[model samples]
Target: MTQTYSTDWDIEKYRDDTEPEEHWELRKAFMEAHKGNFSEEYLVALARTFTNIEFMGCSYPAAVMRRIAELSKDVAKTYRENKKTKLQRTFVSASNAAENKIKKRQSDPGVLPAARN
Candidate 1:
């Protein structure tokens, strides 16, 4: 017998014990649980611990780790410069979109400018 399921977030998709669980990935859950909770420095530090590839030289592993840390720190530094909240991010995105739309209109030859009072 086939069962119908609704497209929803809260609904568990699987009922059969034999089915392999692939739909709900662990990485997605990890992202959801830790979204906007930690600073970038913390994340870079955490991520660096996970990547432990050894290089050719005696001090290669340490050098690789340091390089990884530097890259992660650079990425974190750019985004966390302002450290805007979720609401702030939303506002910034919306305002940027609106600004872009205005610019597009101004640049488009077919679109007429707004009437001045």
Candidate 2:
């Protein structure tokens, strides 16, 4: 039997195997290096790093992840505002649901207190 692999497959496999920590380091370095000149490659790489970290179920600080999520949501909102597509509308709806859940959790009270003697 013969084994063959495409270059694209190899690249993807390599990326999939890359450590999230390394990706995060690279993203940080890129941001610091290109602070004012944000290139498409840097943005894409950062997004990929975040996706990889999310997919691998890596442990990150809740505050950091929440901030990342908030930034992503803001970008999505901007995209939706610019595009005004049905898909974007759906995304907005889903975002509303998520926000509602968060709000409800925050507003919800636990068990009621019993009457004082």
Candidate 3:
């Protein structure tokens, strides 16, 4: 089971994020070191270290990161519950809207085709 897919598109930042580019200490350090005279192996080692920052996600899809982040967190619980509630609200709203449109159309006799005598 070596199959894997990237979830960066599902990420909020990748979707419609207006936020500035994220900064990381490892990236900053990597850039600083790369600016100096360093051997290929040394740069490779640094790259490896930087990549290790996400070592936990090495074998898992990026989507799992949100689940891991939610583990043992109050915000996660709140988000889950709120998400359900919001979904329910959306369903009700859509149903009502459909019903209203049907009613509006039915009430307006001119909108319907005339019956044959």
Candidate 4:
């Protein structure tokens, strides 16, 4: 029997096989290159990497992992709050623009109601 594998399935298998140290190094490099501004999903993935570390027998990795998780939580919270504020502002601006257009049309003389037929 032949089995078909999806891209997502292959990607997950590769990621699961990667070393914890390698994952940490890649995340560090990305944080440095991106100035700590990454997607919420990526940040959560980084936090999960701490749990997958091979050195579970050691305490240091656990400590560092806890710290990363906390930091990611904070960043995600702030990102969500900022996104909410931006959406609210956008909605208000759009509502105001629509109101102004209606007012303008009501004042224009060319758009008068036709007399009864």
* TM-score, prediction 2: 0.24
Tens-digit lDDT track for model 4 on 2-115? 433222221232234455664554444334333334454554455455334422423356677586656545434443466467634234588898888778877777775562
Q: Estimate TM-scores for all models.
A: 0.23, 0.24, 0.22, 0.21
Q: Model 2, 1-117: lDDT tens per residue?
A: 543322221122333344576554444443343333334454445555455454454546787578556545533344336545534223458889888877776666663334211
Name the lDDT value of residue 46 in candidate 3: 46
lDDT of 3: 0.41
Off by over 4 Å in 2: 1-38, 61-64, 74-117
Stretches off by above 4 angstroms in model 4 are 1-44, 47-89, 93-98, 114-117
lDDT of each: 0.41, 0.47, 0.41, 0.48
Tens digits of per-residue lDDT for model 3, 2-114 = 43333222112222243223323333334343433344444434433443333222434555445334321432344346546663423468889888887877777776455
Which runs of model 3 end up more than 4 angstroms from their true locations?
A: 1-73, 88-117
* Alpha-carbon shift of residue 17 in model 3 (angstroms): 7.0
Task: Give the Cα RMSD of candidate 4.
Answer: 15.9
